[model samples]
Each structure stands twice: as C-alpha cells, then as structure tokens.
Target chain A: MNQPYSSALLENAVNEFAKLPGIGRKTALRLVLHLLRQEELSVENFGNAIIKLRKEIKYCHVCHNISDSDTCSLCSDPNRDDSIICVVENIKEVMVIENTHQFKGRYHVLGGVISPMDGIGPSDLEIDSLVKRVSEGGIQEIILALSATMEGDTTNFYIFRKLAPHNIKISILARGVSVGDELEYTDEITLGRSIINRMPFNETFKP
Target chain B: MNQPYSSALLENAVNEFAKLPGIGRKTALRLVLHLLRQEELSVENFGNAIIKLRKEIKYCHVCHNISDSDTCSLCSDPNRDDSIICVVENIKEVMVIENTHQFKGRYHVLGGVISPMDGIGPSDLEIDSLVKRVSEGGIQEIILALSATMEGDTTNFYIFRKLAPHNIKISILARGVSVGDELEYTDEITLGRSIINRMPFNETFKP
Candidate 1:
C-alpha cells in the first residue's frame, strides 16, 4: 500500500508547503500535485526564483528592514524628512502606515518590540541605532505608531527615557474609544500626553 | 515612489512569489518579509528545501511522475497488477483513486490529454509507451479513468482505438449523481447508477 503511490519527493514538497500559514495537508498535497503536473519550464521558474531570493536579498542596515542591498531606498532618499522619524516595532507596520498616505515622515524599523516575558527586551531590538540617530541632533520629533498594547507602551516608554536628554518632541497616536461600535478588546491605557490634558475617568468625579 | 524600493533581488523575489496562484503583490511582500523575519538557520532550511526540490527531485522514467530516484514506487512494486494498467490523464488523479485502496493495479500516467486546441495531440501524450506495453502483450486491462470532459472522452476514444488489437477488459468508473448533492444537480441515468449501486461512490468506483 505504501509503495502504490506518493514518492518521498512529493511527500517532502507537501511538508514544506504545509508549513505555510492557512495551508492544510490536503491543500499542501494539492499544491505539490499541481507542481508535479506542470511542464519543466514552470517548475524551473519556481525553483530559480527561490534560489534568487536567498542569493540576492539582504538587509538595509540603517532602517533594519529587509532589502535587496545595504542601504534601503527610504534611507537613501534625499526628499524624505530627516527631522521627523516614525518609530515602529516591525517593518510591516511601516508599510501599513505608508498605505494610509497620512505619514510623510521617514521610518525607523525597530525589528521587534520590548517584550520581557517573551525574552525580547530593549537590547534585543534596534533601539541603539535609533538612539544614535537621534543623538546626532538634527531629528526634531519621534512619533510612536506602535499598537496600543502593553508591550508597545513599554517600548514607547523605554524609547522616551533614552530620547529625553536629546530634547526631542515625542508623540503617540491619540486614543479614546474607537469610532466603530464594536466590543472593547482592551481598556489598558498608558496615558502619554493624554494625562496632562486631563480627562475625567470617573463619572461622579467633582470639578 | 518607484525607486523607493529598488533591487532586482527584491523584485525577483516578489515577482516569483506573486506568480503563485491567487497570491497578490501585498501577500508576496508579506511572505518575503516573513522569510526575512525567520532566523538564519530556518531561512537556510527553507532555501535548502527549494534547492532539494529543484536538484534532487526528478520524474520517474516509467510513470513520468515526480520521484526522488530513478523509477517511481508504483512502477517498481512487486504485487501490484502490471497486467492491469489504470490509465490517467495526470498524476493527481492517481492519488485520488489510490486513496480508495481499491486499486491493486499499476498505472500509466498519460502526462496530459489530446487537446488539439492547446497543441497537445496523441503524440504529445505518453501513448507510445502505452502502445509498446500493449504490443509486448502480457497486459490484461487498461481502465480509461480520464475525466468526463470532452477532451477526456476524445483522448479515451483515441486510446481505445489504438488498444483495439489487444484483448483487455476495459471498464470505467460508473457515471452517477455525486454524493451529497440535491436531485436537481443529477442527470437521469447518473442518478439511476446512484440508486442501482447505492454504496458510496468512493467505495466502489474508486480503485
């Protein structure tokens, strides 16, 4: 029964495809089967592309983003703002914000956030490079567009402490209840500049 | 904006990823980013898998199905009925029938059909090997398990004509109303077969 069909090469291909998110064993098998069905040319294209990816792509040292070469285009751009830097936990977030067409400032991808429980502290991130960039003294403000989560707040605070001596204006996205009427996922707040503005949390609190 | 992300390497990676069915530019970007996020060891494993897929994997000469080595396991099997060949248009269909465990016969993967519109004729298919196998004269049956489509029928008829000289009991999976479907989707005689056989379609028609 084992020898009736399904060679180990096909099995290995299925296993590799199943490692991808949202792909189940049946789908993985289907994909591998599709690859097997193709003529030599299509299969060759798939194989060659993957090899090219590994051989050619590298990291942008300045922004710590995935790139084809040493310096990323964003870092090399002369028209981009040097004064304002948008700090994000992941390069994924940078793309998301960029899609909104709202942020004109350049980015500083931190690689990851400060999650001590996950064994990812500030040192594990690209925080040192960020500090060095700010310390060079031309940067005016740092906008933290990190998710409104505990780890994001922690990383934001850590960056704030490191940047305070440099006399830079720090900003975070404003938070109140969201516009969409949905069930609240979180009430955890860090109250960055919001505390200074002073909102009454308790309904019965006297003026 | 065009030059904002420049690299033949990155472009090639994205282009290759984007070529996959249903994958878009955004998703391709995300996949590349995910690869970049993985540790070097893990990325190496991914790359190695692709390399192995390209270099190590090859088609079995006998069945023309993908295999790691010379002959596919089915063609090499000792107990399977070499006399009874279940001919299929593609290797994917082989798994579909094999999963039923009913088929104890060997297979002749046709590679593809006789689609004149697509410039694929009987000569393009593995019909020559099949004729040679038949001409050698030990084989008993060739079950034409091609799809119910027009091209499949055309290919099956052509093979039947070629195989007319040989004495073989030719049978096909009985046409029937597909399981778990409404009566409306059924054509009359196919529905008749469902009522007549009445066991599961996979149980009997399979193998």
Candidate 2:
C-alpha cells in the first residue's frame, strides 16, 4: 500500500536489466519506463527481442562468429582470398577489418582468448581448427590480427605453434599497436598499417 | 557485387546506432546484428517496439507526463492531495520526488524552464495551466521543486510572480541543492529534505 508511484514488477524488471554492461540503474529505468509508456505491441516486441536474442542467435559453425545461418556468408564467399586467413578475437573485429576495403582475406574468429586469470587456455581456443585449416592446404598465408594484450599475445603464440608444421606462410599484424590497447579501439589507418607490415613469427611470437 | 564481409547492411546500421547517447557502437552493432541473427519474429518485434513507442505514447493531459491515456494515474488518484501541487522541471524529476514517498501531493510538470538562450520561455512551459489550477483551488500550497541553477531560479521567479496574484502560500524547493547542480542528480534523501524545508520567495528570490 505504501509503494511510491508504480508497479514493483516494472521496477524489478528494470533493475534486472540495468545490470548489463555499460548500463546504469538510471538508464535502465529510463529504458524500462520508455517501454512501459509504449503500447502493448512495443512491450511485447521488447520482450520478444530479448527472448529471441538469447535463443535464436548462434555462432557460425565454420568461423564461430555471430551469424543468422550455419556457415557465415564470408565463409561461403567464393571470391574472398581463401589462400590468406586473417584471425581475430571477435566478430566485431572481423567487421572492423573488413570495413577498411584493403584485405580480401577470410577471417577466423577465436570465440575468445587464452587468459588463465579469466580461466581461458589453449584448449579453450579454436587453435586446432586453425591448424587443421592450414594443413588442408590452399591457405598460403595465416595472418594474426589479434589485439595487443598479454592474453592476446598468449593466444597468438598458441595459434602460431599449432600452425608451425603447416606449409602456410605465418605472419603477425605489425607491432606499432601499443600494449593494453584493444584492436577494436585502433583507427582503421593504424589497423591497416599493422596488417600491411605483418612479420613472420619464427621465435619471439612462438608459443 | 563487391562487399567482402558477411552482413554489411546489418553491420553498418549497428555502427550508426551505437554512436547515439548511451549505446556504444559495439552494443549498437550487437543489438543490430542480434536482430539480423534472429528469426523474423524478433526483428519485427524490435521494429514494432520503436514504432509503438513513437505512436502510442502521449503526454497525460493533467500531469503532462507520458501515458497511454488522457490523464496520468497520479492525477486521477483519489488519495493524492490535489490542494498541494508540487511543480517539477521534467518527468524524470517527478519520479525522483515520487521515490521519496514524502509528498502525498499532486504534480505540475513544467516540461522545461525559461532559458532564453535556448529560446524557452514561460509560454513554452505548462505555466498557464498551473496558474489556472492554482487559481481555481482549494490549494493551500504550491511547492517549487526546480533545479537550483540560474535558469531554474529564473523559471521559479517567473512562476512565483504569476501565482502571487492568487495570494496562495507559495514556496520553492530549498537551496540545499548546491549551486550549478541538476535536480536529477540529487539523491532522494537530500531532495526530500529540501522539499520539507522549502523557502517562501516573495521579493528576495527574484532577479
């Protein structure tokens, strides 16, 4: 009886959703109230979006990147340079690299990186698939476009080691990317330069 | 014919929307790509929500707050004290005041204040309706819960002068809210205390 203005149900839902990354309680309340102020069609739509996002969306079977279908359109593309595969940390990175219009190479998304602190390790990454893909031949060069981080380096080394025996030319997207900065945060020019100045990982980058 | 990446249309839309106020491009892309990744129901739902929000929601006639109906529930609530109307800058402020549970009074939402630089004036506010509401009344008091800024003070003075002819008990929310601070950022406890210990501005609080 002493409730201030509205339903607790609405407040509870807002509080629950406000816990998402980059969302504050105030912003969450704003979104929730915005939704509440809408017609039932909007409310139903919001709920369906949340539910469908959680249930329907899945990673592409081949690349492990987010996709509406099993094999992503990039993986199925016949024109993309299949002889060169550029590896990235996330699907978001894949888009960033693609937006530059420089690289026509295919992308391999690692789902995540190898960080023992975050409980991510070699087995956790898709290093085996990278190795298998390179061994299967047509791949002439494998470029590592991972972020400049301790964990990103660790993951890169693990992939490098796994592909060492393969006949493909192995290279890492250049060094000017300072440590602690994410690849996603880098501008397109810098990312492009890093890709163009790729170096062979013989020793320093070996796992 | 020359797009290299998988879902170019969805990717571009995600990046554009992410640049908005609170949504980062990653989250924006995540949301847009999430829609692309979903079945038809989810995508349609997201579109429907945006449309319903724009079309179905309208300002309540009495409180001038968002609602599906003519009058907000607060204005129609029989238990709410109609004689005491607390005036606030925006609907967000209304929620803050309501969260305090201290005021059992009705509300008059001004929409915004008299900022001549931004080209807003008294006529732009719901001041005329407030004057009419105060004029027709069993009203004992009109509490001003405006922000303690230059523009807020200006708006308060304008309202005070308009409602003064009615010879009603007119008070403003305290200066306890520090100089150059918005009403929204003030905590509930501080805001509630400011309301309870309000000051009567007759001639001294003017420009």
Best model per DockQ: 1
Per-residue CA lDDT of model 1 for B12-116, tens digit only, reads: 767766766667777777777676555656656655565566556767787776667788887787988888889997777888788888789888889888999
lDDT top scorer? 1
The DockQ figures for the candidates are 0.24, 0.15
The best candidate in terms of TM-score: 1
Where is model 2 more than 4 Å wrong at Cα? Answer: A1-19, A30-61, A67-79, A99-102, A116-124, A176-207, B1-5, B12-16, B22-27, B30-59, B67-73, B76-79, B176-207
For candidate 1, the TM-score of chain A alone versus the native chain A is: 0.81
Estimate, for each residue in B34-131, the C-alpha lDDT of model 2 and write its tens digit: 45545666455444444455555567787786555678778888998988999998877888888877789999999888999999989989999999
Clashes of each: 1, 0
lDDT of every predicted structure (CA atoms):
0.76, 0.73
TM-score of each: 0.76, 0.67
**Model 2 DockQ class:** incorrect
Clashing residue pairs in candidate 2 are: none
